[model samples]
Target chain A: MSHAEKKARTTTDEYELIYWPRLPGRGEPIRLLLEEAGASYTDTAHEKDGIQKVVGALKPDFDPGKDNLPGLAPPMLRCGDLFISQSPNIMLFLGERLKLIPGDVEINKYRVNQLVLTMLDLQNEVHDSHHPIAVSLYYDDQKAEAKRKAEDVRNARIPKFFNYFELVIGKSEGPYLLSEFSYADLVLWHLVDGCLYAFPKAMNRQFEKSPKVKELYDTVAKRARIAAYLSSERRQKYDNGIYRYYEELDE
Target chain B: MSHAEKKARTTTDEYELIYWPRLPGRGEPIRLLLEEAGASYTDTAHEKDGIQKVVGALKPDFDPGKDNLPGLAPPMLRCGDLFISQSPNIMLFLGERLKLIPGDVEINKYRVNQLVLTMLDLQNEVHDSHHPIAVSLYYDDQKAEAKRKAEDVRNARIPKFFNYFELVIGKSEGPYLLSEFSYADLVLWHLVDGCLYAFPKAMNRQFEKSPKVKELYDTVAKRARIAAYLSSERRQKYDNGIYRYYEELDE
Candidate 1:
C-alpha cells in the first residue's frame, strides 16, 4: 500500500493541529491537506475550550524546549515530540510524510514550496485588500484605504497571479501544479476558494481569464475527501478572517 | 571533506542568481548564504543589462518549461536545469546543497524554514511600514499612513518578534536560533541589520531589550565573508529597496 493508504488505515491520531476556533484562516489549508491525505489528526478547533487552548499557545514568554520550539502563531502542527508553526512549514513537513508530493523528492519539493509561498503572498495581499494600513485596525477604520487597495488587488495583482497559474497548469503534464496532486495545489485551491468568496464579482472576472485555475479549483473541490471535508462541520466559513467580504471593497 | 568545503572549491558558476541590480532587497539573504558557504555563482545584478534581465524574467506570460519555471519576482536562483523563486524557497534549496543547515536534516530543515519564513514576514512588515497603502503608490502619497504603520511596527511588532528571537537564541544551543549558525540566522541577521539601518532609534531601544538578537546581529556581521561582502561593492546600499530609511517613519 502507498504511504497515504497506510495513513488512511491508521486509527490513532498522530498529528495534533493547534489553531484558532471558528475561522478558516491559515489553518484551513493544513486541515485540507490532512483530510485529503486521510492522515489521522486532531484539531484543537474541535476540542473543548479550543479558543483558550489556542490563546495559551501564544504566550510571548515561552520556552523553546527540546526538539520543540513554540509556534509563533496558530496553525502549529505537533507530531510526537516535534512541534512547528507557519502554514507553509507545516504543509512542507506533512507533504513529505503524507506523500502529497510528485516526481523526485529532490527537485520538486522546492518548486512545491515556491508555489505555496507565492500563493501565501497573494493570500496576504488579499488580506491587506481589506486592511491596507494596519491589521490591528478595524475594517471600519481603514475602509477608504481598503477600497483603493482592493482596486490594485483586483485589477493588477489577481490577474497577474491568475494568468501565471493558468499558464502553469495549462502547460504542466496534469491539471494540478507540478503535474500532480500536491500540497501546492491545496494551497492555491484554498486561496482561490477564499478569493472567490471574498471578492465574488472581481473573482468572476479574474476567473474568466483563468479558466484553468477555476477548473482546478473545481477539480480539487470535487475530490472525494476534499468534497466530504468541505461539507463537514470541520470546514470553517469565511468571516472577519483573512478573506473578508466587504461590499464597498469589492468591485 | 565536508559538503560545504567540497562546494567551496567548485570553480564553475553552476548557480546563477537573477535579481535586481544594485539593491540588497530580498536577495541579501540568498547572497549571504552563498557567500558564507563559499559557493561559486554568477549574479545577474553584476552582469551587463542586469536590469533588463531581471525585468524580462518577470514576464507574466512566460511559459513554465520542462523542469524549469520562471520567478514571479526578483532573487530567482537557477541551478543546473532547475529554476526556482521566492527568496525563502531559494534559501531552503541552497541551504541543503551548501550544507548551511545544522543537526538532523529532517528535523532542522523545517525549523530552519519556519524561522526564515517568519523573518521574511517581518521583512515584509517592515516594507509595509513605508508602503502601507500600496506597494505601487509612492511613499509620499501614503506618508501619513506610513507614519501610522511605522508607529505600530516600532511599538508592537518589533518588540514581539525581537523578544521571541532573543528568548529563542538565548535558550538555543548557542547564540543562534537553532545554534550552529544556519540560514535562519543569516535571514534574521540580514533582517535585523536592515531594521537597524531603517530604525536606528527604535532599534536601539529594541536592541537593549533583545541583547541576544543584537549580539547575533553583530556576530553575523563580523563573519569574515559577510564583513567583506558588506564592505565590497557587491553589497548594495539601501536605496529605495525593501528596507528604506525614512526619517519620519523611523522614530
Candidate 2:
C-alpha cells in the first residue's frame, strides 16, 4: 500500500489497556482519546481481577510470550502482538492510527508532541504537590513538605504552565491548541480537569489569570463525545491518584 | 528520490541550537547525538552574546520572521525554516535523521523513545531532590525539604530507576540498552554522569548494586567522540544546574 493509503486505512486491531482499577491518573488521557475517536478498546482495570492483570504485567517474571514486550508500569497498551508502555508514547501511536492528529505535516505532528510533553511536565508538578518527597510514602508522611510544595505549584508553577498554554492558544486561530481539535487539546483538558479536582481554590485562582486556557478547557469539555464520556461510568473519579485533593495541600 | 536514496542523502542544512549559555542540563543529549553523527551544527549558547540570543528568542516579543515559529523555551533547534523545542522531542528528531536509532523496525524506534522518556522521568526526579518546593526557589530556601527529599531519592528512587535500567541492560545482548549502541546509550551515559556528579555518595551506593548500568556508563564514556567532547572546552560543568549537589542534602 502507498503511504497515503496506509494513513487512510482504519485499524481493526483490538486494544487492551491495563492500569490501576480506580483513580483516573495517567490512564484517563488514553481513555479520553479512545472515547473521542470512538475506537473499540477494553480497559483491564475495569474488568474482574483487573488490578491483578495490571500488577501481573508489571512483574519481573510476568511473560507475555516471546513475541510480546514487557511494560515498565501501569497505563500499558496491548494491541495485537505489541505491548507498549509509556502514556505519551501510547497516545502518539493511537493518535496516528485513529487519525485524531491534525495534519499530515511532519512539523505539525512534532508541535503536537511538544505540547503533550509540556502537559506531562505540568502534570508531574501537580502530582508532586501531594507527594513532594516520595511516591511510595503516604500523604501523611510528607504532609509538611507537601504543604510547602503545593504553595509553589499553585503560586508559581501552575501560572508558568498556564501562561505558556495561554500563549499557545493565543497564537492559534481557534479555541484549540492547533486551531483544530487534536489529541493535544484532549491531553490539556484532562490535565485542567485533574487540576480542578486536586486544587480547586488554586486552579480557580490560576484560571482567572489564564482566560485563554480556561476557554480551551471549556471548549474541549463541550465536545459531544467528550461530554458523554465525562458523564459515563467509565470516567473514573479523582482520588489518591496523580491528582489528589488534600485540603491541607491547598492554601 | 526513492525512499532508500533519500535516507542515504547527507543533510547539508545548517543547524543552530539555542540553549542556556552555561550547564549541560537537558541539552547534553542533543550535543552527544550531534557529535556522534559528526553533524555540522552551531550552538547559540557557545557564541558571543549567546545567552542574550537565547533569552531574546524566548521572549514573547521576539520575532523570527514570517516563517519561523516561536519557541516556549531554550534548547530550541532551528533547522532551516522549522523550529522545534523540548529536549526529548528534539532528540527523537535527531535520532531519526542521524540514523543513530537502532533497527529500521518501527517498534524498535518506539522502544528507543520509551527508554529516553523513562530517563527523562528519572532526571526530573533527581532534579526534584534539590528543588522539591519550586524551580524558582534556591536550594538554601528549601534546604530542610531538600534534605528529606534527597534521602528518599538516594535510598528509594535512585535504586528503582537504576534497577529498571539494569534489567533493560541485562535483556540486551550487548553493552548498550539495545545491545547495539543507540542514542539511548548516550542519553543514559549523560544521566549517570550527572547523577555521579550531583549525588556522589548516593550514586556510589546505588551503583554498587547496579553493576550493569555502571558498566554501560563506563562503556559509553570510553567512546572516542564522547571522550573528545568531554575533554573539550565545549562541555559545560555541572553547577547550579539540574543536578546540583548540596552536601547537606547527601547522607
Candidate 3:
C-alpha cells in the first residue's frame, strides 16, 4: 500500500506525529507503543526541506499574548487541538491510551516517568559521544573529544547505568516492571538495543558484568510483537542521529 | 530534630530516597514532589567521600538469569522492599502517591510525561551551557567552548523549549496542563524558577514574548504550600550543578 493509504488505514486519532523521515532516533519508542496498542494515528515524516511546511502545519494560530506559537522541534504530537512535543511525553500519552502502564496509578506514573529520564540520560550520553566538543562542530572536527567522551561513557556511565537498572529489575518480582509489561520496559529495551548497536564493543564488555541487564534486554526482545517489529523494516538502524556507530566510540 | 532522630522517624515503607547527596541536581524534582505531597521519605544521599559505604548501602542483590532490574541512578525510591530510581520515575511514582496527577489515566500520563520531557530538554540545554566542550572538563576549564555553546543555547534551544511549553500552557483550558495540578506542573515551575535564577538577563529578554509561560510560573509560585516550601529551608539556590550562573551564557 502507498504511504498515504497506510496512514489512512491507520486509526483516526487527531494525533499527528511529525518527525524526521529517516532514523528512528527518539521517535521509535512512541511509534512502537502505538503499534503495540494498535492505536490509529498519523505518523508524518518530514523531508529534509519539509521542516518549514511541517512547522507551519503544526503551529497554532499566531497570538503573541494568548497563543504560544511556533512549537519548536519535531517528534511533536498534535492531538485534537493540543500540540505536545518531546518523545517521552508522546510515549506517556500513548502508554496510557494503550494500557501499557500499570494499574497502580501512583507507582505507574513513577515507573514511566523514571524510565523516561533514564532513556533521556542514555540519549545525552550517546549525543555526547558523537559531539563531545560542541554541538555546532561536526563529528570530524570533534574526533579527539569524541574519543575521550566515548571512553568515559563506555567506562564510567554505561556500567553505572546498566548496573542501576539491573538492580531495579531485581526488585521487581516478574517479567515486567510493576509485574506487567510497561512502555517503560519497551523504552528500556530500545535504549539497550540502540546502545548495543551503537557501541557493540563497549556494550559487549559491560554486558558480561551486567548479566541482569542483558537478561532484561533478551526478555524484552523476545516479546512476540516486539520480535516481529524488530524483524520488520520499520525498525531503522542508527546512521546520523543520536546514536551512531563510530569505531572511536567503542573500545 | 537531630538528623539521626529525624532519619529514624522516616518509616522504611513511607520514605527512602536513594541518590547522590552532594549534587542536588536530579533529586531536586523528587524533593519538590515529596514536599508538595507532604509525604515522608528518607533522603539517603550517597556521599562521595565514603564511596564504599555508599555503594554497599545502595547496591541490590538480584539474580540476572531469572529476573531483571528496572533502574540505576540516584533519585531512586525505596519503599519497603520495592526500590525504584530515575528522577522522573521517582517523581511519577510520587506524583500518584501525592495525588498530583489527574484522574483520567491517558491525560494524566500524557501531561506528566510531557512535563518530564520538557525537564529533560531544559536539562540538556543547561548542561550544554556549562560543558559545551566536554563533560569531562569543568565549566571553568571549558569556559571558552561553553561560551560558544551558551550562545547557541540562548539563541536557539532556550527560546525553542520555553516557547513550546508556553504554548502548552496556552492550549490548556485552565491553570494546569490538564485543568488540575500535577507533578509536571510542579516541575515546570521549578524549571522556570531555576532558569530565571540562572539566566536572569536571558530570561528577561526572551521570556517577555512568552506570557503564557510566565503566567503559569506565577500561578505555580502562588500555590500556598509551594510558596511556603520556597520560603522554607527546603528550597535551595542553584549551585552550578545543572542550572548554574554563567555571565557569558546570556546574550
Candidate 4:
C-alpha cells in the first residue's frame, strides 16, 4: 500500500480497548470515537470474561519487553503492538489517526487537546463530588460530604464549564467545538449526555444559560453512527461509575 | 535562518508565560521546563503590573481573531503569535521544539505525554485534598473535609502514584523517565518535590518504598539549570497553592 493509503487506513481490526465492563465509565468516549469513524475495535469491556483482560493488564511488574509502561488506571488501547493507557493520550493518538480531528496544521491538534483536557478535568470533578472522601470507600461512607460536594458541582462548577463550552463553540462556525467535527466534540457530547443522566434537573437548569451547549449536545445525539451506538446493547448504563444518580445528591 | 538552525533554536526569548504571581503552584512546572531548556520566557506573574495580564486574560469573552479559545484557567502561554493554555499542551509544544523528548519518532512523544498527564492528575488531586468541598471555598471553611481527604491522599493516593512513577522510570535505561532527559522527568521530579514540601512526614515515610523515585527527584534537583533556577528569585514558594503544608492535614 502507498503511504497515503496507509495514512487513510488508520482504523484496523486489531485495535483492542481494555477497560472494566458493565458501565460505560471513561471508556465510552473512546468507543464513541470508534463508532463515529466506523473503526473496528475490540472493546474488552463488552466481551465475556473481558474484565479479566482489564484486571490482568493492571497486574504489577510490567515486563520490560512488552514496552508496557505502568499506567495507574485503564481505558488502555492497543493498536497493533503499541499499548498505551490514559484516556486523553489514547484520544489524541486515535483522533489523529481516525480523522476525528482537523488535519494539516500541527498546532490545531493541541487546540483540540486543550478542550478535551478541560472537559476531562470537569469529568473528574463530577466523579469526585460523589466520592468526596475516598474512591476506596463507598458512597454511603461519605454520603454527607458527597451531599455538600455535589451541591457545589451542580450549582457552580457545571455552569462555569458549560459557559466556557458555549463561549468556545460560538467562536467556531458550526455546532462542534471546532468548525468541523473533532474528538473534543465527541468527548463534550459524552460529558453532557452523562451529566444529563446523572443530574438531569441541574443540567436542565444549566441548559437555559448554555443554549449553544444544549444544542450541540442534541446535534451530536442525532449523528447517525452515534445514535446507533447510544441505542445499541453495547452502550452501558450509568451505574457505580463516574456519573451516578443518587436522588439525595441531585438537585 | 536555515531549517536546521530553526529546529535547534527552539528557545526564543519571546516566549511569555501567563500565570499567577508569588506562588510556584501549577505554573512552576512550566517554568521548570523553560529553565531546563534555558528558554528565555517572560513570566507574567512576576513583572510590574504582571498580575493584570493574567487577570485580563481571565476576563470573559474570547476574540475569534486572537485564536484565544476560552480556557478555564491559566498558565496560558504565548510563543511568537501562538497563545495557548493548559500546562501539558504547552509542555508538549516546547518538548518537541526544545528536544525535551527523544525525537524522530512520533509515537514516543505520546508516551512522554502519557506520564506527564498522570503526574498532573496527581497534582490536581493534591490540590483537591486541601479544598475538598469546593475551590471557591477557603481552606478554613472546608477544614473538616480537607483533613479526611488529605489523609486519604497522603496515605493512599500519593504512594500509589509514586510507585507507578518508580515503575515507569525503571522501564528506561537511566534516571530520566525515558533514557535521556524528557519533560516527563521534570514533571515527576516537581511532583515528588512538591509532595515533600506539602506532606513532609508522609513523603519521607513513602520514600522508603519508592527509593528510585527519591533518586530521580534528587537527580532532577541537581540538574544545572534546574538547580540554578530553584535558587533564583524566579522560583516561588508553595504558599496558598496546590501543595500546602498544613500540619494537621499532614500527619
Candidate 5:
C-alpha cells in the first residue's frame, strides 16, 4: 500500500482486547466504551485459543527473541504497534481517539482521568471486599473476614464514593458527569452495574440516597448503543469477575 | 499587568498542595517532583491551621456558597485555576510543567502514566496491610487481621511488585524507569522509602532478590536535589501514613 493508504488503514484498524474469558471484570469498562462508540474490535477472550493467546501475548518472547513490554495482568489492548495495559490508561487513549472526552481546554482531560482513577479506586475496594485477607486465598477461606470487610464497604466506602459521584452529577449541567456523555460516565455505569450484582440489597439502599447518581445510571443504561450491548450475547455474565454476589456478604 | 506580562507570570506561578497535615501519604510523590524540579510550592500540610486548610478545601462551599469542585480526599494540587486530586493525575500535571516527563513522543507520556498507576496500586496494597478491614477502623482493633494481611503482603505481593519493577528496569537502559530521570523515578523512590519503613525486615529480605530495584532506590536517594529534600525539615516523617512499621507485622 502507498504511505497515505497505510496511514488511513492504521487509523481505521480494529482494536484487539486480551482479557480473561469468563469474567466481565476490568475489561467490561473497555468493552462498554467500544460498544458505546460502535467501534470495531476483537475480544480475544471469546475467541478460540483465547486464553492461550492472552498468555502468549503476556510472554516476553511473544514476538520471538524480542523483549516486548509484558503486561502485569490482562485487560490489555493492542492497536497497530501499540500494546498497553492498565484499564484507565487504555480508556484514556480510546477516549481521546473516539472523542469521548471533551476538548483539551487545559485541564479537561485530566478531569476525566481523575474521575476514572477514582472509579478504579472504588473497583479495587469492591474486589477487596470478597478477598479481604489475601487475593491468594479463596473467598470461602476468608468468609468471615470478607463479611466484615463487605460491611464496612457497604456502610462507609460505598456511601462516600456514591455521594461524591452524586455531587459531581449535581454540579454538572447534564445527563453525564461532564455535562455530556463521556468515558467517565461509561466507567461509572459499569462499576455501578457490577456493584448492583455484587451487593444488590446494599446498592439498592445506597441508590435511594443518591438520586442524581441513580439518574445517571439509568440515563447511561438507556443509551441506544449501551442498551443494545447490555441485552446482546456479547455482554458476558458476572461470575468469577471482580464483582461477585456472595449471599452472606450482602446486607 | 498587560496580557503578555500576565501570561508570563502565570507560567512561573508556584503551586499549593493541600493534604493531610500528618502523614507523608499520597502527597509524597507530588513533593518529590517539586523537590526534584526545585520549583516553588507550598505544602499546606506544614503550615499552621494546615489540617483546617485541607478540611476547608474539601467542603463544597469552601469558596462560600459558590459550588467549587471539592477533592474526594487530599494530595490535591492547585495551580492557577485548576484544582485536581488523585496522586497520579497530579503527577501528570506537574510532570508536564516541570519537564519531569519526556517530551510527548507518541506513547511516551502514556507509558509514564501506566507506571505511575501501577505504583499507586502497590501503594494502595501497602496501606491495606495495616488497615485490612476498613479505613474507618483503628489498627489496634484489627491487629489480628492486619497481621495476617501483612504476612501475605510480605510473602507474596511485595516480591511480585518488586520483581515487576526490576524487570521494567532491566528492560530499559536506565538510571531511571524511562532511561533517564522522570516523575516515575521520583514516585518509585517515595514508595520504596515508605515500604522500607513499613516492612523493614520484609523489604530488606525482598531487596536481596531485586538488585535493580534496590539500585534504583539507592540512586534516587542520592540525587542532589532529592538528597537535600530528604534531609530537609520539609520532608515530613511518616507517622500515620500509608506505610507504617508495625513491629509484629514485619518479619
Candidate 6:
C-alpha cells in the first residue's frame, strides 16, 4: 500500500471520554467542547470501587507488549489506534480535530495552548482548596489548613488569575480571547463558573476589578448549548469533585 | 505579494522567548529545546522589582501593548509576529517546529500533548509540596504545612506518578518513547531528576519498582547539551519555589 493510502486509512473516533461521573471535575471542559461542537461521544462514569475495574481493563490493554497503546493516565481517549490520556491533552486533540480552533497557526496555537495552561492553573487552585495539606487526608482532617489557604486564595491568587484572563479578553476586545468563540472560551467560562460556585465570596470580591471577565462568564453561561448541557442529566454539580461547597473555606 | 513571496520576504526572528530570568522555574524546557534545535532569537525576562532597568535596556523597543507581541506572562515566545506562552505550550510548539515529534498526526499530537500534561501534573505536585496550604503564603510562613504535604507527596503521590510513568515507558520498549526521542521524554526525565533531588528518600523508594523510569532519567542526564546547560550558570536550583528543598519534608 502507498504511504498516502495508509495515511488516508487512519481515522479517529469522534470522541470516547471516561471520567468520574459524579461531578463536573476536570472533565467539564471536554464535556463542554463535545456539546458545543455537537460531537458524538460516550461519557462513562464509574461506581464506587469501580475505579479498580476501570483501571484493570485499561492496565492490560495498555501493556506495551500487548496493546501497542502507550499512555500515562486517564481520562483516556481511544481514537483509532491512538490512545491518549490526560485531560488537557484530550481537549487539545479534540479542539484541533474538530476545527474548533482558528486556522491561523500563530494566534490559534497561542490562544488554545494558553487557555489550556490557564485551565491547569485553575485546576491546581481548585484542588488545593480541598486537599490543602494532603490528598490522603480527608477534608475534615485538613479543614483548618484549608481554611487558612482559602483565605489567601480569596484575597490574592483569585484576583491575580482573574485579572490575567480579563487582560486577555480586553486585549482581544470581545467576548472571546481570540475575537471569536472557540473551545477555549467555552472552557474558560466553565472554569469561571466552577470557581464562582466553589468560592462565591472570593469570586465576587476578585471579579469586581475585572468586569469583562464577569461579562464573558455571564455571556458564555447563557449559551444555548452550555445552558442546555448544564440543565441536562449530563451536567453534575461541585459536590462530586472539582469545586466542593465548604463554608469556612469561603467567606 | 504572493503568500510564498511574503513569507520569503519577511525575516522575522525564528523564535522569541519571554520569561523571568531570576528563576528557571517553568522556562527550562523551552531553553533546552532552543539549545537542542540550535535555534536563535530573543529571550525576554521582564524585570521584577529592582531588575527593571537591566531588562528595559535589553529590549528598549518592546512595548507589550503596541508591539506585535502580546504576552500575559513571562516564558512566552514570539516567531515572526506570533506570540506564545505557557511552558508546556512552548514545549509542544517547539516540538512540532523542530521535528522533535513524529509526523503521524495522532501519535505526534497525542503523545506530545500527554507528555506536556504529565509535566504539568508533576509541576503541580512539586509546587503543592511547598505551598500545600497556601500559594500566597511564603515558604517560610507555610513551613509546617509544607513538611506535612511533602510527606504525603513523597509517600503516596510521587510513587503513584512514578509508577504510572514507568508503565508508559515499559510499553514504549525504548531508549526513547515512540521509538524516537521527543520533548516529552526530555521533560519527563527532568521531572524525575528534580523530584529525586527534592525528595531523595521518597523518589528512591518510589523509583525502586520502576527501573525503566530510572534508566530513562540516567540516559537523559547524559545528553551532552543538557549536561552542559546544567553545568552552566543557566541551570537554577529549587529553593522556595516549586520542588523546593525542605530538609524537614524529606524522610
Summarize candidate 4's per-residue lDDT along B170-192 as a digit string, tens digits.
Answer: 77755877766778999988899
Tell how far residue B4 is off in model 5, in angstroms: 25
Candidate 2's displacement at residue A246, Å, is: 2.2
TM-score of each: 0.95, 0.93, 0.76, 0.95, 0.93, 0.86
How many Å off is the CA of A12 in candidate 4? 3.4
Q: What TM value does the first chain of each candidate achieve?
A: 0.93, 0.93, 0.84, 0.93, 0.91, 0.85
Q: Candidate 2 on B1-251: residue-level lDDT in tens?
A: 24454245336667788888788987888999888766779997689988998989878777754434466676888887778888888888888877777665466667788788889898998899898998888888998888888888888888888888887787774488885778889999999998998889988988888899999999888777678888999999997888887777777
The reply for model 6, stretches above 4 Å from the true place, is A1-13, A46-53, A57-71, A103-107, B1-13, B41-72, B103-106, B237-239
Query: Model 5: which docking level applies?
Result: medium
- Backbone steric clashes in candidate 6, count: 3
Question: Taking the tens digit of each residue's C-alpha lDDT, what string does model 2 give over A107-151?
Answer: 666678788988998899999998998888998999988998898
In model 2 chain A, the worst 10-residue window by lDDT is A1-10
lDDT of 5: 0.82
Say which prediction, candidate 2 or candidate 6, comes out ahead on TM-score.
2
Tens digits of per-residue lDDT, candidate 5, A51-129, equal: 9988887674454122235567778888777777889988988887766776563457778888998989999999999
Ranking by DockQ: 4, 1, 2, 5, 6, 3
Q: Where does model 5 exceed 4 Å of error?
A: A1-11, A60-68, B1-11, B63-68, B103-106
**Clash pairs, model 2 backbone:** none
lDDT string for model 1 (B3-116, tens) is: 666456344447889898877888889999888777778898899988887888887665445666666777898887888999999999988888788889879998999888
Instruction: Report every candidate's CA lDDT.
Output: 0.84, 0.82, 0.67, 0.84, 0.82, 0.69
RMSD of 5: 5.3
Worst 10 residues of 3 chain B by lDDT: B61-70
lDDT over C-alpha atoms for residue A160 of model 2: 84
Which 10 residues in a row give candidate 5 chain B its minimum summed lDDT? B1-10
- Among all windows of ten consecutive residues in candidate 1 chain B, which has the lowest summed lDDT? B4-13
- RMSD (Å) per prediction: 2.5, 3.9, 7.1, 3.5, 5.3, 6.9
Question: Chain B TM-score for each model?
Answer: 0.93, 0.92, 0.82, 0.93, 0.91, 0.81
Once superposed on the true structure, which residue ranges of model 2 sit more than 4 Å away at CA? A1-10, A64-69, B1-10, B64-69
